[model samples]
Target: MKARAGGPDHRPPLISEHDRDAAVHRLQEAYAEGRLSHEELDESLHQVLTAKTHSDLASFPEENESTIAAVSGRIRRRGVWRVPRILKVESALGRVHLDLSRAVIEHPVVDIEVHLGTGNARITVPRDAIVDVEDLRTGWKDPLYKTRRRSRPGGPMIRISGTMGLGRLKIRHARR
Candidate 1:
C-alpha cells in the first residue's frame, strides 16, 4: 500500500551525528570556495548542528553512519571493515570489542559513541592514531587508556564518547 506523506511509514529521516558533521564540513567548504559568507557559514553551521531531520539538512551535504547494537552476549567488530566517520555502539548486557588497527579508515577524525548498559568495552586503535576520552562518562569505573608512542602528525584522531552504566572501557594502540 502506498502511504501518504504524513502517514506512519512516511516519517521524516532521522538525523545522525555523522550527518551533522558532514553538513558542517560542506558548509565550511562552501565558505572556503566563496559561495557562502562568513556570517552565512556560521548560521548554517548552527542550523546543521541543531538539525533533527532530513528537511533540516536541505541545504547541506548528506552522509550516513554505522551502528553496532546488541541486547545480550558479545558484540565484536574487527577485521578489515570500513569505518565510517561516526560509529555508534550500544549494548544492554554484553561485552563489546572494536578493533580499528586493520580497518579501513577514510577520515581524519573518527567518532565512536558507545552506550553500554552492563558490560566492558575494548577498543584497539591504530598505532599512529590519537585518542581522546575526555567527554566519556561512566557510572562505575573510569576508562583505561595508555599512550605507548607519540601520535603521528596527520594520523587519525579517534574520539570516543558516551555513557557506560556499569563496565570498564579499555583502549590500547595496535602494535606495528
Candidate 2:
C-alpha cells in the first residue's frame, strides 16, 4: 500500500513479542560488540517499553519541502552511480523516507544506520532482495520500529541505526 504524506496509513503497527525480542536481541549484540555504551542502551530500553503508538517510538525530521527536495535530489544522484559493491546509510535522529521506485543500482549490498532519541519507524525493502536486520536501543522498545523485507534479486544488505522519534524508510527496486 502507498503511504501518503500526513494521511493515516493503517497497517496495524507491526508490533509483536517476536518483534520486541528481535529488537532487544540486536541491542544486546551491540553492547557485546562495544558499539553502544551501557548507559545508552539502558536509556533506549526504557523508552521502547513505554512507547505506545509508532510516533511514540520513532524519530522524524521537520517537514521542510526544501530540505526534502535537497535530500531527495542527493539520493537520486547517488542512486544513479554504478551500484557500489556495497552501500551504507547512517543517521542520528529524525525520520528517513527512501523511495527506490526509479532507482537503478548494480550494487550487491546496502547498509543503513538509524539513530533515535524516542519514536517509531517503518522501513520497506524491495520485494525480491535478501535482508538481515539488527537494532540497538536505549530504553523501553529501545528501537521502536517495524521492518519489512521483500524478496528481490541483487542481494542487498541493510543495517539500520535508530534514535528518538517516529518515521518510516522505504526501498524500491528496479524491475529486471
Candidate 3:
C-alpha cells in the first residue's frame, strides 16, 4: 500500500499486532506445506510472539555493537586494501601507532586532527609521500614538527592538525 508523504500513515509502527498476525500466518503456511517441521514451527511462533519490537524481530540473538566494532577495526587495519582513500584517526588518550610501510598507494595521504589531554602522538607516512605539517598551538616547541626534506615530485599529501595539550607529533616517510 502506498503511503502519503509526511503523514502519520507513512510512519511504521514500532510494534504492530498486524505484523505479529502475519508472522503467525506465514508459520502456519510453512507447516502446512511441510517446509517447517513441527518443532521448528513452534519455536518460530514462540519467537514471533515474544518479540516486542521490529528491532527485536529483525536482529539475531547474538548480534551486538561490540561485534560490529571488532569487524570494522579489522577491516580498517588492512591498509593495503585502503589506498587512495582518506583516513581519520582520533584518540582522546594514549598514542596511535599507524604502519605506513604496509600502506601501498601511489600517494598515500593523511589528514589528522589531534586533541590530547596528555601524552604524545606520532604519525608516520611513506617516504614517497609529501608531508604537510600545521600546528595550532599557543605554547612553545609547537609540540609538532616535520623533518626538513626537499619536496619530491609526485609525493602523497600529508596534513596534520594539532590542538591543545603537550604532545610531540613526528612525521617521517616509511622506508620500503
Query: Which digits, one per residue and each the tens of the lDDT, describe model 2 over residues 128-171?
Result: 55544455333444333334344545444545443334333333
Candidate 3 error regions (>4 Å): 1-85, 106-109, 135-141, 144-152
lDDT tens per residue, model 3, 40-113: 67788888889787755522122111111121122123356344333445444455555565665532344545
TM-score of 1: 0.68
Off by over 4 Å in 1: 1-26, 29-61
TM-score of each: 0.68, 0.34, 0.45
lDDT of 1 by residue, 1-176 (tens): 89999898788878988888888888988666434546767778888888899788748433436898899999998999998878999999999999999999876678899999999999999999999999899999999998766666867789999999999999999986
| RMSD after Cα superposition, model 2 | 21.4
Per-residue error (Å), model 1, residue 89:
0.3
What lDDT does model 1 reach?
0.85
Between candidates 1 and 2, the one scoring higher on TM-score is 1
Candidate 2 — which residues are off by over 4 angstroms?
Answer: 1-93, 135-153, 162-176
Q: Lowest summed-lDDT stretch of 10 residues in model 1?
A: 57-66
